[model samples]
Structure formats: C-alpha cells, structure tokens
Target: MKILAIESSCDETAAAVVEDGRTVLSNIVASQVEEHKLYGGVVPEIASRRHAEAIVGVVDEAVKAADCTLDDIDAIAVTYAPGLIGALLVGVNFAKGLSLATGKPLIPTHHLRSHIAANYISHKELKPPFLCLVVSGGHSHIVEVLSYTDMRVIGRTRDDAAGEAFDKAARAMGIPYPGGVELDKIAENGDDAAFPMPHPHVDGAEYDFSFSGLKTAVINLIHNKQQKGEEIPVADICASYRKAVVGCLTDNFLKAAEDLGYTTLVTAGGVSANSLLRRELERLCKGKYTLYMPEKSLCGDNGAMVGSQSYYEYLDGNIAESDLNAVATLPIDQRGF
Candidate 1:
C-alpha cells in the first residue's frame, strides 16, 4: 500500500510516501533550524507560520519525488498530536483536505509512536515485542511494543526530556539553538571528566528518568564560574554534560532491557542520532541484545516514519475521520479515535 504522510510537529515541515511501511519512495523535510537559531529555540508562532508556508510545497515535492499523485495513494496519514498545536494543525488539516479531495482514508498517528516506527523503515527485520528508547526534543520515553499498533510506555521523564536538557545546557554555555548537535561536536575534543555533573538516579522507578536536576546543576556550574571570573573550558563542559546524559540514558535503557528480557533494543527520535550514545550502546551491548537505530536523517522529525506507522494503524482499524484535530500533549498509549 502506498501511504502519503505529513509531519509538522515542530520546526520541520515534512512529507513522504511510503510503500508497505518498509520502503520509502520519497521523504522531504524543510527545516527551520536556521530561522529558529536566532531565538535560541523554537518560537511557536514562527513555527506555525513556517509550517503554513512550507506544507503545501513540501507535499508537492514529496509527490513529485515519489513519482505519483494523490490518486495513487491509498491513504493520507499525518501526525496529529504531541506537538505545537498550530504547527501540527497545518499538517493535520492539509492531510484532511487531501483525504477529502481524493476520497482516501485518513490515518492519525502519534508523534512518539512514529519515532518508534522509524526503526521499521531502517531495519526491515525489526518487528513488535521489542523495547524502544525514544529520546527527542520534547519527550523521553521507554516503550514496550507489543505489536505494530499496540505499544505501552513503560517509562518517561518526570521533568525535562533529555533533548531539552541538551538544548538548555548548550544555551547556558553560550551555544546556538538546537545545541545538541553542536555540543556533541565540541564534546569530541574535550575531557569528559573535566567537570562533575550530577546524574539523578530515581529509585524504585527503574525505567523512569529525570534530567531537570542535571540541567540545574549545569546552570549552577556556569554561574559559579562567572562569579569567580574563571575561564571556563567550553569544550570540557560540553563533553562532561554529554557524558552525563549518555551515561544515564544508556544505563537505564540497558537495565530496562535486561530486566524485561527483551532481545531486541530499538533507539529512536532526534537524540538517538547522538554519536556517543550510538558508540556506547554498541560497545556495551555485545550479544546481550541486538541494537537498532534509524539513519541520522530519519532520526529527527520526518513523514516517512509517520507513514510507516500509519500503515499499521490502517491494518489495525485505527483510521480517523476528517474531524480529527491536533493534540499538543497526547500520550503514547492513547487509542480510540
């Protein structure tokens, strides 16, 4: 089945056509990273305006690149939840209009679920009943995929998500917006042990995560340095911060997988593109479980992953009506309508 998908969850306006969930005919993403950089982060109003301006062109390009038109697609799928409401509405409403005009099925997909399904597009052998660690700009979750359409979030961040921590920490260090990638690069040349960053180890909730304390600690360290007029090693701070986050994330995920006896481990979302996490996971997880990560491009927000999950949603009778609306704070396991 050919599914045309749209995703404007945040700063990116994307579209794609996916065949049978595994193959991507075409994926087009127009990012507003450069625009948002000046503000040091995403501005909701700007994001919404950009989505409105870019969504139509993005979809047209996706269709052209896929070598097909609206008639050839069996369904119009879109991410309708867990994002900026206005940003998401542009994609959701555009997709609804397409479904109406072409008389195709409308499939609604969750943003987090789409991230998890990114693994499906990357690894054809990957299937259900696996453990997925989803670390993104707005969310951090550990989910148990019981089936393609059935997933339960086993753990999530109680405070700021991992990606949020990265961005905030980067801002504190005078880095640019979307600091995660820049911080990672600077970290490559510095000493991970230069600064001591706290790792919040929440007891009892073995699968849950907390990064707010870590973020605060970094802020405090920066403030202390400024007070003393001490020359702060920016690279070292970046390296140490990255190490703390990666270490905590890797440890918790590994512990969860081991405790649940899951043989397949899938990592997804924007933060999954981190080099340190990828290397550490590969180095530590030898024979214990198979690790899967999406290609760097697919790791961030995209429509192909949404289309991939939309196929399963269709198979599971998860279609939505034209009245479907954008949800800014939807849950991972939410079902019905």
Candidate 2:
C-alpha cells in the first residue's frame, strides 16, 4: 500500500510517500530551526504559524517527488497527538481535508510510535517482538514492540527526558539553540572522565529513569564554576555529562534486554542520534545482542516515519474520521485519533 504522511508535530512541517511500510519513495521536511534559533528553543506560537504556512507546499513537493498523485496514494496518514496543539492542528486539519477531497482513508498515527517505525525504514529485516529505547526531547521510554500495531511501555522517565537534559545542560553552558547536537560535537574533543556525574537510581523501578537530578547537577556545576571565577571546562564537562547520561540509559536498556531475554535491541528518536549512545550501544551489543538504529537523518521528527507506521495502523483498522483533531498530549500506546 502507498501511504502519504504528514508530520507537523513540532517545529518541522514534513510530508512523505512510503510504499508498504519500509520503502520511502519521497520525504520532504520544512524546518523552523533557524527561526527558533533566536529564542534558544522552540516557541510554540512561532512553530504553529510556520507549520500552517509550510504544510501545503511541503505536501505538494512530497507528492511530486514521489512521482505520484493523490489518486496513487492508498491512504493519508498524519500525526495527530502529543505535540504543540496549534502546530499539530495544521497537519491534522490539512490531512483531514485532503482525505475528504481525495476520498482516501485517513490514518491517525502516534508520534512516538512513528519514531519506532523509523527503524523499519532503515532496517528492512527488522520486525516486532523486540525491545526499543525511544529517547527524545519530550520522552524517554523503553518499549516492548509486541507487534506493528501493539506496543507496551516497559520503562519510562519519571522526569526530564534524555534529550531534554542534553539541551538544558548545553544551554546552561551558553550553547546555541539546537543544543544537543552542538554539545555532541564539542564533547568529542574532551575526556569523558574529567568530571564525575551522579549516577541516579530509581528505588523501586529498575528499568525506569531519572534525569532531572543529573540535569540539575550539570547546571549547578557550571554555576559553581562561574561563581568561583574558575574556567568552565565546556568540552570536558559536556563529555562527562554525556558519558553519565549514556551510561544511565544503556545500563537500564541492556539490563532489560538481558533480564527479558531480548536479543534484538533498537533505538529511536533524537537522543538515539547522540554519538555517545550510538557508539556505546555498538560496543556493548557487539557480541551479545543485535542492534538497530535509524539513519541519522531519520532520527528527528519526519513524515516518513509516520507513513511507515501508518501502513501498520491502516492494516489494524486504526483509521480516523473527518472530525479527527490534534491533541497536545497522548500516551504512546494510545491511538491519536
């Protein structure tokens, strides 16, 4: 089945055409990164306005690039939940109208679920019944992908997510707007053990994560150095911080795989693009487990992932009506429509 997907869940307005579930024929994204850079982070109002303005052109380009028209698309899929409401509404309403006008089926897709499906696009041999570490700016979760349509959250964050923590730490050190990516680049030149970071533990939940304390620790370290009139070791500190965070995430993720007897491990979302996480996972999984990660370009929000997941959603009867609305927040396991 050919699926045309729309994604405006955050600062990106994207569209794509995917065949079946894994092959992406065309993927187009209009990013608001430069606009948001001035603010050091995403501003919801600006993001929404940008999405509204770009959705039409972006979708049109996607269709054309795929060498297909609306008649060739079997279904129209859109991200409808767990994002800035106004931003999401642009894509959802546009998709809804497109479905109505074209008389195509509308498939509502969950944002995080799309991240997991990104793996399918990158690794055609990948299938369900494995463990996935879904870490991003808004969420940190370890999911048991039971099937294409059925997933269960095995572990999650109690506070800030891994990417969120990365951004917060970078900002405290005067990093640019897309702090996580910038931080990762600079961290490469420094030692990972220059500064020690607290390794937090969730008392009762073995697989669950807690990053709020660690984020605070990094911020506090910077503040203390500034107050003492000492030079802040930006590269070294970031390296240490990245090491700590990666350690925490990998420890629990690998533990779950070991305890649950899962030999196949996958990672998705923005944080999975982190060099430290990717390298460490590769080293750890070398002999014991199989590992899969989305191509770096597919790590962020995009329509291809949504289109990929929508194929499975359509087969599972997760279609939506014209009245479908965007939601600011929805659980990963729930249907967006």
The number of the candidate with the highest lDDT is 2
lDDT of candidates 1 onward, in order: 0.92, 0.95
Model 1 agreement with the true structure over 188-232: per-residue lDDT tens digits: 999999999888888889888999999999989998999999988
What tens digits encode model 2's per-residue C-alpha lDDT throughout 1-337? Answer: 9999999999999999999999999999999999999999999999999998899999999999999988899999999988899999999999999999999999999999999999999999999989999999999999999999888998999999999999999999999989999999999998999999999999999999999999999999999999999999899999999999999999999999999999999999999999999999999999999999999999999999999999999999999998999999888887655
Question: Estimated TM-score per prediction?
Answer: 0.98, 0.99
The candidate 1 region of ten consecutive residues with least summed lDDT is 328-337
Assess candidate 1 and give its TM-score to the true structure: 0.98
Backbone clash count, each prediction separately: 0, 0
Worst 10 residues of 2 by lDDT: 328-337
Off by over 4 Å in 2: none
